[model samples]
Target chain A: MAEPLFDRLALIGIGLIGSSLAQVARREGLVREIAISTRSEKTLERARELGLGDVYTLDPAEAVADADLVVLCIPVGACEATMQTIADSLKPGAILTDVGSVKMSVIDQIAPHVPDTVHFIPGHPIAGTEHSGPDAGFPDLFQNRWCILTPDKSTSRDAIDRLTAFWRGCGSDVDTMEPGRHDLVLAITSHLPQLISYNIVGTADDLETVTKSEVIKYSAGGFRDFTRLAASDPTMWRDVCLHNKDAILEMLARFSEDLSAMQRAIRWGDAGALFDLFSRTRSIRKSIIEAGQETPAPDFGRPHKKGRD
Target chain B: MAEPLFDRLALIGIGLIGSSLAQVARREGLVREIAISTRSEKTLERARELGLGDVYTLDPAEAVADADLVVLCIPVGACEATMQTIADSLKPGAILTDVGSVKMSVIDQIAPHVPDTVHFIPGHPIAGTEHSGPDAGFPDLFQNRWCILTPDKSTSRDAIDRLTAFWRGCGSDVDTMEPGRHDLVLAITSHLPQLISYNIVGTADDLETVTKSEVIKYSAGGFRDFTRLAASDPTMWRDVCLHNKDAILEMLARFSEDLSAMQRAIRWGDAGALFDLFSRTRSIRKSIIEAGQETPAPDFGRPHKKGRD
Candidate 1:
């Protein structure tokens, strides 16, 4: 274990990311004391039962009272309210950050509420499983993954360095970008794909000609891959859609236009167009695997549970 | 080892499924002699180098000349020409089958050329990896997967039972359905998902607002899952779209309608609609897992390699 970086680390909203931070911080000795708080009582109990924090409370203000580092791990839509609740109680000179997926809206909503005495450095860790909640948190969730911080010019360099060091301690490679740019990047990479998956699954579910059982039965054909993303937490994804509206809609427009072109190719039986697009996309997957963003094995390298693939 | 089901088996196209049939058939002693043929001479050479078959031929007619069972494992669009090429050479009373994704189209294309003396039973094993070609084939590709056979009343019971036994030997659970119903079912489950995946990847590639490197680096946010299906063979997917046009267009229309509604919800900040859909879809993933169609691991249960999750 390494020396503690902060006297106390307070995490508000202990869901997947929050619980994961608690696990990694405790395991890596990044903080001397971990305080967990959430608005929901049941989730707070679950976090305490999991022993994810040293101090547990439902009051956000109490959680961050003396904390040297405060990380908000709530829904992106809740940032403003959460900041309003705990802003005045933040320790003087404390480094404040967050793990929201949408950075632009988060900065817009929460930055005004933050005090001048505290450093508010908004961050998003580009890592998670489809599963959520305290039980889903694993110590290695951030290992080898990216943790991006969106810090404006007004932010202190010392605050940014400390947060970067904290993320690095949790096994993440840290990168910094502008908040608006971060939102645009994540909208295509994260938000748009999720919305598309959820939409297609809903389409299959609402089909009149096809039975749901049939969809589930032959899902191995290709449908099961989409289900993984569709199975993600509803509250989290809903908030992502609401908070990252402009970028999501912009990407959706482009995606829909592309879909129309693909549909026309199918209608006219343009095999060359379809084949060229499909072939080029295959190379992108290869690039992603080569860059270490994805696994190389077939079927996402699902383990041999019943038999070999 | 199981007793030989056929004295000789002819595979007309030695790609992914054909090469896997060669491996499993040889490994399980299901066929005494394995004959491999492909229109592409380079593929035939690769299959021969991999020792996927005992007899290698460049002619589909030569491959099926004396074989007791003939399997067409080419793209759905190629079935008609392949059937025309091999019709005169098929051994009398031979069982003919295929591993195409689209069943009704395969039946429509190949049935007329088949002699009444031969039993034609179209089949699709609801199993595959995105990777294709001879090198991508493995002996256990069909293990614990479903193989659906679409046989009309004119199809002899004896032929259906034999093909069922063959798939069972390859470690698959066999089920039979009508050809038309099979097309509709696969349209929603396999074809639609594949088309959507290809479309999204293309959309991301063509995006000017977001850089490609950002998409690659932040793919773990959810975009990477679709890339797996998008990486599938261009020629194979092109044929599927062409052969299954009606069903695919129907599904695409429904998918587009649903996507429009979802877009409206996000535009209006209908968090309830988004949350409800997300919640309902999660159960489908659970059902797929419980039905043994998917792995029960977070993040597709991707195996850890050099680093962490």
Candidate 2:
């Protein structure tokens, strides 16, 4: 049998991503010993019941002690506090990483307090569903999905390679990007889509003309599609929005500007302009499908099929 | 089998909705003969090849002649032109209905041309997917969906009943609604979702930091959900925006206003407000699932298992 990638790994905040990493890492023999930590005893107990880790603890510092790798799996808003709590106990030469969505903010928050001897390589795993918590994750959550690493010039090549190797072992294609660029790219691709979904659902909820029952009843047509993203964990997403403010706000501004132009074309009945823009966007979806980034309809969710990523 | 609903029924556009109607209508013996027509000669030929109808024609007038029911199955933008072309050829007392997304504009366009002898009842089958074309349709497309009728006071009860029975034969539950209310309801439920989807896809495509490949690759995380709606037929959605101007703009404005408030909350790191709104919207999705209007992963392309949908 092949040797495991790490002798011991510590995962702070055993939620969706944390539990998912534990499952996949164990399934792939990526680690021998796993330590799980969370502030809530209920979640810690739940993680232990699920057998997500070999050991579960309530202390982040205790979890990180004697570990070769430590991954912060908490919400972005909780990153700074978790870093402060664990900094004193992080083993020297251990590679520290995070499975956060917003890179720049995470780096800004956690980089200042980390000890120089430990490698602090920040990353965002571009994967997840609307579901949250330990129960929500599975062993194949990162398969075929991109896990981006945003490292600085001062970062050691050995640290990047070790982290990259770990993600690959757990079934992720790795891409290294600048922290700011990562934030911007994700602002458009992930953050904005979620914001739009949440906002639209909120708007529909507030409407007087359409009864909530009617919206629910008739949602199969199109509205149902948005609700899945809107149904994502509120606390986690709230932290994401607050953490990635600038880029999200910029994307929002651009979206509103484009939407106003579309509104004008609709008001004046400019079919040509509306048709042209709508057609152009259709091609992008085709590309996304052709590139196999998304499994297109009827195939993406084959009944009782195993997870792709 | 019961007597046919009509001696002949002409479908003047053989796309997803049109071909699906033809398939169900034929499957249930709802009409003695079906006349299929489209502006595109290739689509007409394809319909003929699929055995979708007894006669296929590229000419709208030729298709409508001698038919007891003439359904305009084309995009909303072409309704006026198709009505103008077929007005002189319509058989007396024929029931004139449409499957357009926008009701008020459709009534305005086609009602003026209908002769006093004919009964004009505009409608919209609240069902469809992003896929288009004749081959993309199926017989069960309308099964268990709502088919809304927007008939005015001048419409005869016999005509309404016949139309309702025809939709029932196509597997839809039928309901009657005022044209304006139908438009507003659809704006919130259907049009707004499509518009927001298109705008967000466009925003992602226009992003500089996120390369197209990166966006496509990471899309499954969240962005791919919107792509299905964004991939809808460009001509159809363009017409929806043009014809449903007031309602779409109203919904867009409301959506933007809510987005601004959300932006402010995120900027201020107001986790409580964000969590409240986000969590509240989550229950609506639950209601939609309970209502059986959606699957657990609604955007997933799989045909939901029996008892799940």
Highest-lDDT candidate: 1
Clashes of each: 0, 0
- Per-residue C-alpha lDDT of model 1 across residues A1-309, encoded as one tens digit per residue: 668999899999888899989998998899999999999889999998899999999999999999999999998888898888898899999999999999988899988888889999999999988988888888888887889999999899998998999999998889999999999999988998898989888998899898888988899999999998999889889999998898999999999898899899999999999899888898778888987788888878865334632
Model 1 alpha-carbon miss at residue B24, Å: 1.6
User: Where is the poorest 10-residue window by lDDT in model 1 chain A?
Assistant: A300-309
Q: Which stretches of candidate 1 lie over 4 Å from their true place?
A: A304-309, B304-309
Model 2 TM-score is 0.93
What value does DockQ give for candidate 2? 0.45
lDDT of 2: 0.86
Q: Model 1 has how many clashing residue pairs? A: 0
lDDT tens digits by residue: candidate 2, A102-218: 999899999999899999999988878788889987876777778999999999999999999999887778999999988888888888899888899999999987899778877
User: Relative to the true structure, how large is the alpha-carbon lDDT of every model?
Assistant: 0.90, 0.86
TM-score of each: 0.97, 0.93
